[model samples]
Target: MSAVAESTAAFSAAASRELGEGTNDTPAIAALRSEAVALSSKKAWPDSRKERPWKYHNIATLDLGRYTPGMSASNGAAAGVRSCPVTGEHAAAIVLENSDVIFSEASPDGLDLIAFSALIDGRLQKLVDERLGSAVAAGTSKLTALHYAFLAGGVLVATAPNSEFKEPVRIVRNYSGGGQFAAPHTLIVTGANSRVHVVEECRSDEGDIVVMPAVEVLPGPGSVVRHTVVHRWGTNTKVYTEQRMVSERDSEFVSLQIVAGGGVVKGHLESSLVARGSSSELYGVTLGTGNQHADFFTTQDHVGPDTRSDLLFKSALRGHARSVYYGMTRVGLGARNADANQENRNLLLSDTARADSDPVLEILTSDVIRVSHGATAGPVDEEQLYYLQTRGIPYEAAEALLVRAFAGQVLDRVADEALRDELSAVLDARWDSPE
Candidate 1:
């Protein structure tokens, strides 16, 4: 077998061994496990050479055999990791370490918070079965299939009908221990006429580890959902994440993504408006330094009439870092009067830094109201730099200032002032300007 195939088999063998120890393998989980095993047993990696989506992000070169399943430490806590920045002062928190739930809080009145295993065994089993893997179909990719097959502890949150939370629900996941793999999932369901906000923060201590996570959001008719995600893995880590949100009639969904760390990071985000008058807004920002590689893929799918979507993604790369962004807006035949727009922009801070952006729109209905997409990858604006320099700022500081301003456009759009300020501080610490 080739090296990739060999590594695949090794990872699968390790996962199977870990599955033997998990305590919450319900019938639904059992079915998923069987499907995942069948697909992964093929020992085939994603075909980057033939697939357009995989072309920019290549994982075939990595040796998966080097990493084993992440096991809970004897201490039962994530050591050397900082406490969750999002405290209970503003939101309830769920803490996970190595895919194990270490701490969690009950949601405020009018909402139910449970574990994924409990969700499957309770009255919501049908709902979970119907929507669990719908957004990210299993067996489509090697890692995805493996994730489902070896799924561990995850959070399940549901809001009651017409209920509105005063604060966001926060989930803080910290990954530690070197040479291990952690896969966690999150599912959020909003009832009719309900409103909620959620924030997910992911980080890792120093380790050469792999963290793969998936999140799915289902909004009922006339519901509103706002979610924010921040990922700052250690420099020795690689991250692969899949996130999707599906909106029903007259619902609104918004997502903000900020990525700043990891040696190799790949993320896929999708939002679908499946009923009339549904709308979605997606905003993302990425900052890369050192030799980091960051890749993001996004899709805005409109399947019903009078639906709308807007997307904006920005990136800044320095040193030998590289970034890639692929965005698409698809309007189905029944999506008459649908309005969709997408834009991607990147800034290179050094000669060796690289960026690639692809934005496309697929309009199947001629009766659509409006649709457009655009992308730009270029160096920092010389004029902006010169202006800052003329104000007595050093060249390096000037460049950093310009880069910060460029990234702040998306940051300023965040609704929570506290969360916005916290992210801004992190940006200051992570943003690297060429010396």
Candidate 2:
């Protein structure tokens, strides 16, 4: 293992000891937890002066230590907590509240589903042992390390080879009010020649809460997977999200992330094409208003020949809100005939609002077919606003129209019609009255 991984494994050991050992954990999981705990002791919240990831982040302004661990109670059992309204009869719903799985339903023939807390020792153990933490290796990031060391609970989902699901699997997680820390983990594996779809939603009630969520997706050879994530937390919530995926030979992966709520949110999304003939599309949308702050980091890695990847992320900022985006597209050595693209665009709606974008590309192979990255941050175009105003649109209405269109560029990519319409309406309501 590398020095960083060793440090994290050590931290996991110590943190897990103090965090309370779970008797349900199998030997491998227990060992993994120990390593994460060992690394946690040496790592602290990101420091603007010391960590590049936190350099543009205002860490000193946030009081994260005040949050306590989440209670092991389901929202259904708690008072004043509301369930998500976005549900369909055709979809399977898994509702997670705090550290408990409140509800889960899926067809046995469609998906092999199991809860992480339920895997003590058994057949699933071998698969979990091999795939867990394989994509985002331990110690890659401090927050990621902490997530592994102290994950609250999550589920594992897999589809049988050549099987198909007619409807999407919807996973909804709700965090309740209080200074609570909520950590949720998810692992998805799709078998060869199979197809799977998943839609995940994260929301919270009114309160000061901190949320830490991690997800890993593995698409087996010749598989196709589509996933969507929507985050809509209250103003007092701060969230750190980690999402990673590894695609195998001849597999295809598509993902879309929509961020619209939370006082402060930071996230990392990565797509790693680890085998030849793999392809992926990554898309994201961020809408910030008031004093909201949103930051997203992304990576597209081509580690095998004949791989292709593309990424597009858009952000709209109003009021004194702030937004930042940084991305990297890397082609590995000997990964010839690889093609990758990274693009980020930001729109500022007020003089006080600010946005920053950085897109980078690293091509390590001499025969890289094409690799490019571009970023742009600017205000609403005056010409376009003027054109709208001249056509009888009010100034504020015209600005809103353009802003909604800017964000819709990404929202429109969502393949689910219901989700797309719901998100579009929410986006309109959110930016209609920006400060």
Candidate 3:
């Protein structure tokens, strides 16, 4: 058999064993896992030379058989205190370790937060069945299929129609254990005219592990939703994330991604404005140090008339770190008067640091208002550094100041002051310490 075939066979066998050992799975979940395993078996492993999305990373080096699926000791029990860094009033908080819920609490408000394992027999079963994989399907890719096949530690957040929350919902996922495969999923569904914000943080222990996280957001008409994800994995961990948002008529969706640490982190973030007057904003900040590699693929999809989208992603790389960004803006034929913009900027702090950026636009409608994109990858300006030095500033401090300024453009856009400050502090620490 070919290498791809062997890898797929090994993964499928492992998933089958896991499924066989699982006795508490609901029928719906069992069916979902079975379908995912079957689909994954038929799909070949992604090849960088053949796939555009996988072009920047090679997965063939990973040993598919060396890692087993992770199991949680929680077993539907809640324990421990919340460890998320985002501090503020929260409507709900859910903490998961190794793809299992260890702690969860929801306020007396109308916001509904529950673990997926508990939702199987609850009143929300129908909702979960309908919206679980609506935004991102299991058949999307091999990695996604495997993610579903080994899905654990899943959470669902929903808002009632016309409801509004003054505080954000917090989610923290912690992964540990060497040579383990972890898959954590989050599903968000909002009713019409509702507004909410979600903050998610991911952390892992210092060991060799692989994580595949998937997030799906579905917003109702006239609703506003904002989501922020913070990634602080260990230097030995590899993470693959898939997050997407689909908006309704007259709705607004905003998303931000912060990458601070990881060995190899790659993700696909997409926003689909599917109804008239819908708008989306995407922002990303990444600090790559040591031998870290961060790769992001983003899409601004306009499927309705008068839709708007804006995206900005910035990264600062030091040591032998590298970063890659590939973004696409698509305006369909029915998307008349669509407005879209994409920008990517990278600052190289060392001669060995590297960055690759590509922004593309595909507009099928001639009545669009505006569509544009820009990308830049370069080192710090010598003139600026010289001027800062002339002002009696030390060379190291001057470079740090320039890097801070470069990252501040995107950080300044965050609406939450506390969260922004915390992220800024994390960035500063990451930039100062050598790998």
Candidate 4:
């Protein structure tokens, strides 16, 4: 095996010892993996594509049964995202721990929560099942297929129409691996005229393993939904994350992603405006030091009239780290007067560190209001350093200050002071004294 693969196997072995002993010993996880095996062997699947002239399509399918052991829990975290949670609540809180219903709090009254697996149990899984393989399939790509074939956690939340949030809802899952695989799924659905914010965080404890995440969201007219996610699994893990959302008339959706720690992170975020007057916003930030590598890709699909979208992604790299950001916004032919923008900014802290960004736009509308995208990469501003040191600040502190500033644009949007400060410290800790 290649050195990278060998190291991944070592991590997975340690994770197996601590997170899970084996699938046979974990019934819930075994069942989840069995489902994945079934999904991977299916052959009647059709090619994925955009149905309309303005719809954006950039789907990559992979086979899941081909999963290989990795140095960390990135794979498990990514797979965990594929499973849906089954909390018994009415407003549908995302569940963790394999068919375990942990959230018993009084769900916001008038809201409805549906478990994806329950659909498999009750025979209503069809309408959605039809849309599942198409959203982010595992047909040929191991990254995606493994998520579909081996879901261990997932959630579907449908809130009341025209309601507002008194507090942000939070969902979190922590994994301490023991040779076991886990999937945590989450789904958000907002009623017409509703407004609310949601957050999801995942942390793995002490073991290097595999993880997956599969999320689906739907927002109705005049409704608003905000989302934020943070994934931190030690240095020897693998993770796959998938997110797909549909917005109806007058609805708005916003998402933020942070990957401050992991071995290899592959994430996909895709949003489609199903009706006119809808808007979608996708944002992300990542930090990688050491031998870490992360890939983030997103797409904004405009299917309705006058829809709008905006996306910004930023990353900071040090050590022997590597990262990639690929994003695009497409305006359908019938979706005129659409306003869309994309931006990707990267920071490299070491000469051997690497960062790559691809920001693309596809416009099918002739009378669109506006469309633009750009990417930039440069070393720390020498002028800023000179100004700081000349003012009596030490060189190392000045450089650290500037590096922290480079990451601030992302840090500012975290919305939670504790998380913001925590991420800042993670960035600050990576700088070395330049004597």
Could you say which candidate leads in lDDT?
A: 3
Models ranked on TM-score: 3, 1, 2, 4
Q: Per-residue CA lDDT of candidate 3, range 7-111, in tens?
A: 555577565547434524566766777888888768877899997777889876677666766556433434555564335667788877786677778544668
lDDT of each: 0.79, 0.77, 0.84, 0.64
Q: Which residue ranges in model 4 land beyond 4 Å of their true spot?
A: 1-36, 42-104, 110-143, 414-435
Identify the candidate with maximal TM-score.
3
Report RMSD (Å) for each prediction in the order shown: 3.0, 4.9, 2.9, 8.4
Off by over 4 Å in 2: 1-23, 44-47, 58-64, 74-86, 433-435
Candidate 2 achieves a global lDDT of: 0.77
- Worst lDDT 10-window in candidate 4: 51-60
Residue pairs with colliding backbones in model 1 are: none
lDDT of 1 by residue, 109-166 (tens): 7776666645544556665666677666667677787677666656777788999976
**Could you tell me the lDDT of residue 55 within candidate 3?**
84
lDDT of 4 by residue, 210-313 (tens): 67777777776889888877776766666767788888789989888877677777677898876898888887777778888787778888878889898888
lDDT of 2 by residue, 1-435 (tens): 465564344334554554435425566666776777566566666777986556578565644445555356643453432554446633456777777666666456757666676674465777777778777655766677677777776667778889887667777777886777776778888889888878787888778887778889999899988887777888888888888898899999888877878888888888888899999889888888888888888888899999999888888888888888888788999679998988889898779888878887788887977888888889999999999999999998898899888988887777778777877877776665434
Off by over 4 Å in 1: 1-23, 78-88, 117-121, 124-130, 432-435
